[model samples]
Target: MKPSLASNRRTDRYQSKTACITGIVAAIEDQASRPNAAERNRSAGPIV
Candidate 1:
């Protein structure tokens, strides 16, 4: 009736991977929504 450690690990990995992918997708969408700002920053280079 108990789950194995391997199964638990697989579930954890899947969850983390899903979160990471979601974050990346959100970042892409944010960048897409502000392409002009992103492009300007890239062209300006590091402000420091």
Candidate 2:
């Protein structure tokens, strides 16, 4: 048995998208705890 080309392409795209989203989320979390994070917190409301 062999994997189809379309399925492989879809999997590659899904992995790439997941990686990009993970990177973005990590970057946001890292920045959200710094000094400027205060302003962000203020704008976002009580959730901070």
lDDT by candidate, in order shown: 0.80, 0.76
Q: Against the correct fold, how does model 1 do in TM-score?
A: 0.61
lDDT string for model 1 (1-48, tens) is 244566887777777888899998998898899878778878999868
Q: How does candidate 2 fare on TM-score? A: 0.55
Error (Å) of candidate 2 at residue 31 is 0.1
Q: What is candidate 2's lDDT per residue for 1-48, written digit by digit as tens?
A: 234576777787777888899998987887776768768768898863
Task: Score candidate 1 by lDDT.
Answer: 0.80
Q: For candidate 2, give the lDDT.
A: 0.76
On lDDT, the candidate that comes out on top is 1
Which portions of model 2 show Cα errors greater than 4 Å? 1-7, 36-48
Per-residue lDDT value at 33 in model 1 = 93
